[model samples]
Target: MLVEINLLPKKEPRNLSLLFAIVTFSGMILIGAAFLIWQMNEKKEELANVENQVQLTNEILEAKRTKLADFQSASSVQELEKAIKWAEKQPYNLVYVLQKLTKILPERGFLTEFNLEKDSIINLIIQFDTKSEAAYYLNSLLNYKWIDEAVITKEKAGDWEIINNKTPLSDDQLTDLAKKNFFPRYYAEYEIRLNIAELKQAYKSEMEKSKEGNKGEEEGGDSP
Candidate 1:
């Protein structure tokens, strides 16, 4: 009989514990992935909301800027109109202007007629007791700083013309009284119209400042 020998290798026990550990770990990873996906979606929604709010704020600021520009334009127009009105009234103050034409006059020199014209011109008509007094008054007026151009057009002697010899006083006495009234500081009655546009310009500047202040307050009060 032939000896039969069977050489068969025995397989090791299957690793059941390793298979269980792998399956449990895979399930945990799937659950973790689902949680991470949920968190990412929540963050995306929050970012989108923040961007929307920023856009809205920008729109509001632009609208307020537009309104402010419009208000400024309107204010400028109103100010111009008010300035024109003020300039128109500047010529009325010429009556109070002091034109000290006669700096020094002889005791007998007296002013007879004074005329003021609207065309910025000065006209003077005077009668003096003597030609020397007239010369003195004329020279003083020419040297005066207020008189721009003092021109003695007609230096003629005048005899007293009796207009009315009424009961009040004699013409000669009245002439003496007139001479005495303006003695030592006799002024030739002259008309001088000065261009006081400089004063008007200064006043206009102040008026503009006041208007600007009012406008600033209005704009500030409307601020949020």
Candidate 2:
């Protein structure tokens, strides 16, 4: 038993301790690398989710814009047409009557007094430079195409001849002075009155009446 114990070599404990320390260091490095890889994967997944949400929001905004554009383009024109139709249905057309009157008035003539009654009769006093002009206006009024009738209610000189009160004058002298135009010459005045019952009636009837009168005259001449 004493000879077996003496054959065993002496053991050094430092080599085993060195081997354990190296193994521990290598294991810690491996664990740190695995944790880093896990963190990187989580970051990539979060980035993908955020990108998807942004794309969805962009699509929704584009759809909303398209809907707004369609509403404006399709509905506005119909609304405008409806408004125009409404305007046509209104009844008070004073503007149109005024336009027609403006066309019928003479070039050099002007109205001195004008009045329209509640019963639709219009009193119009027209002034002209000469009696011939006044007569022409009356003829034109007789030929009017819009009113029922236009008649000359009154005719007179526009300017009155005022004599000096101090001078004694006879009626014949006044008449002579008027004829000789010792005062300013008065322009011709005509009062035209008409009814606005119809837009176009009187002229045609007047033409027919004149034709009938001419026919009667012709027949009388032919009878003997």
Candidate 3:
């Protein structure tokens, strides 16, 4: 009996599924690489813009600082204060003016008005017991060192006088010159304007000197 054994050939499964999986994974890697590259470019652009803005801001701030400094230097109050400070340093003596006035006043004369002005002018109104006394006062003021360009503005006769015995003004005839007060007895009233231009000029000059002094101090402080 020759029985032929029937044998079946071993069947091989298809590898299509593994090939599909590999293709999908490779495509996903490529897409991921593209996205990463795009993100890197966007970040670089943003950084550049930020840097530019910072540079512009710095330039604007520096310009404003320069303008403010210029304005402060040109202010009117600054100029006036500078002038006043300089006046304080000057060697002007108001006491000398008072002394000069005292030296020139006549015994029979009294000051009815005294005005000092910023423009370097002194206005004085004198009331005298006699016209001659007023004349003497004018002559004495003219001879004073601090008085210049004296001019009488008005003159009139008055009859008011005060006699003080304590001043030792004992002139005869009026006999009791020190004890007698008289007004309108040949009286003369006059207004005199004197120039004090020198005082004003001196004040201005001193102010300039002070500015120079302050500048020197600031410069010294800045050194080292």
Candidate 4:
């Protein structure tokens, strides 16, 4: 009569505190590691972008430098062309001037040095046996149609030793020169200015005449 037999065993209370704590700590660690991985990926992307920008900037700078170099080369060529044109326009003819000088030179005097200067100026060193020859040469230059003014800037006695050394001579020639070096000689340095305006006018007239002559020749040849 007393009590019914219990078939099931009595249930024990389970302690879940330590397991829950371990699960919470492991979940936090996994979340933190995932967040750190995401941050690392973002940093790598930003670094790549910065490197690409730097490369692009360098490429742009190189292109600009190439363009600048090309521009400078073009400018230099243009300047050289302008200088050549200016030179062509200048009314200066060395051959014509030399021919005139040869025609007007004194018979007894010889030119030792001749220099052509800017603004159509001629500097000449002439040696003569007498001072009158130098004076005559200067007067002739002054009276020339092409020469505007002529002046004897310097006059001095010629040195035989200096003049002899100017020419290459053999030993026998040098001995003869030494024997004949007793006579005193004179030299004059002259500066002559050319009439540039008058020369330009003359040159223009000659060019016109030449053109007319050429045209007449062509017309004559074409006539039946």
Q: Using TM-score as the measure, which candidate wins?
A: 4
For each candidate, how many residue pairs have backbone atoms clashing (under 3 Å)? 1, 0, 6, 0
**What tens-digit string does per-residue lDDT give for candidate 2 at 1-224?**
36545667787557877788899999989998999999999999999999999999999999998998898877898788886785465432334444544455555455666554433456666654344556666676667545556566676654322342335765345445645664432243333344444442544465589999999999999996
Among the numbered candidates, top lDDT falls to 4
lDDT per residue for candidate 4 within 14-122, as digits (tens), equals 6689889999999999999999999999999999999999999999999999999999999999999997786677677655666666677655456788886766788
What lDDT score is found at residue 134 in candidate 3? 69
User: Residue pairs in steric clash, candidate 4?
Assistant: none
lDDT of 4 at 9: 89
- TM-scores of the candidates in the order shown: 0.36, 0.35, 0.36, 0.41
lDDT of the candidates, in the order given? 0.60, 0.60, 0.64, 0.77
Q: How well does candidate 3 match the true structure in TM-score terms? A: 0.36
Query: Ranking by TM-score, best first?
Result: 4, 3, 1, 2
Which residue pairs clash in candidate 2?
Answer: none
- In model 2, what is the error at residue 104, expressed in angstroms? 22
Cα misplacement distance, residue 139 of candidate 2 (Å): 32
List runs of model 3 lying over 4 Å from the truth: 1-91, 160-179, 182-224
Worst 10 residues of 4 by lDDT: 170-179
The sequence of per-residue lDDT tens digits that candidate 1 reaches over residues 1-224 is 99988799878998999999999999999999999999999999999999999999989999999998899888898899987776466563333332243325444544566656554566776756544465666666655444455556665534332322223655456557556664332233444444446434544565699999999999999999
